[model samples]
Target: MTLRDEITNCRICAERFAATKTRHQPRPVPWFTPTARVLIAGQAPGLRVHRSGKPFTDASGDRLRDWLGMPPEVFYDLSRVAIVPMAFCFPGYNAQGYDLPPPKVCGQTWHDRVMAELPQVRLRVLVGGAAHRYHLGTKAGVTETVQNWRAYAPDTFVLPHPSWRNTGWLTKNPWFGEEVLPALKARVKEVLND
Candidate 1:
């Protein structure tokens, strides 16, 4: 069987969120894109995204939109940028008001295939340890600290999760504001214009 099909039958994640989630195809995301210049690697979707069937449709998405210096119209356009998280669905909630970690099966089964279709990706924003762990294992540190961004590849900037919970981190990491944002914007403009 094709690897993509095997990913659709993922019982590990299905045991939780999928049981209660609205019915649809087994693998819910778009899965691939060709016009994408930048890829945003986040954790799993929250309930909002699962319901909307659009990744990053919540407060976190608002932060990401701001970070990209783009509006909702542009940001949602899959032809421009791609949002492929470590997990695809709403993994349900935990006590901290945060969603659970994305299922390992999703990443282990699907990411490389999807990435294979996105050869033009000039940048990939690895947001959390889940993404950082897989995409930049040896290249970037595994501790989920935003400070280890430089250890990853060029055009790929690792970021702390953009949830409002990270407000304090953003405040503490002024270099992320002073250095990374400008560089990010510059690269974003170059990609969009190309």
Candidate 2:
């Protein structure tokens, strides 16, 4: 079986999910292809993604496409883009109603194995804090890491989660829109085109 299929059919994650206090079933949602040049590495799937079994099928995805200056057809094209989160399954909600952080076990178990299949990836867009930490190691806080984006240029771009929960952060960080988005879109276009 292909590495991609093995990851998609992972029952280890299902067992992990079942053992969670919430006991929700896991539905791994990721897309990978040998030709993909851009990898959208974000946090875990949300309830919406779990229900649909499709990655980035929500408003955050709409905003992410906007950030990349790509329409849905292009952004969702598996041949050009890979969507792999820190955790593949929905990690369930906390008592406060926010989704819980993605389990570290999921990344520990699968990220390296799955990432090994995408040797063509040129741009790794690390969305949210968890992904940044996992890929870039212990760095400054998200804001600082993202503000220092040039340090990881050409190959990696740090971004806050595109969820509406971070809308206030976007408003507060105007430079993200004015300075970062244009450069991000350009790099994304270049990688996908190449």
Model 2: how far residue 120 lies from native, Å: 0.5
Q: How many backbone clashes can be found in candidate 2? A: 0
Candidate 2 Cα outliers beyond 4 Å, as residue runs:
19-22
User: Compared with the true structure, what per-residue lDDT tens digits does model 1 show for residues 1-194?
Assistant: 65434544555555565444342233455533677888888777777776786778789989887887888887878787888888865666665555667778777767888788788889888887788788777445433446655666468887778888888888877988887777777777777787
Q: State each model's CA lDDT, in order.
A: 0.72, 0.87
lDDT of 2 by residue, 1-194 (tens): 88777777876766666665667887788788878989999999988888998888899989988998989898888998999999998998765666888988889988998788899999999999999999999567889989998899878999999999999999999999998898999998887777
After superposition on all C-alphas, the RMSD of every candidate to the true structure, in Å, is: 3.7, 1.5
Off by over 4 Å in 1: 1-12, 18-27, 95-97, 138-145, 151-154
- Count clashing residue pairs per candidate: 0, 0
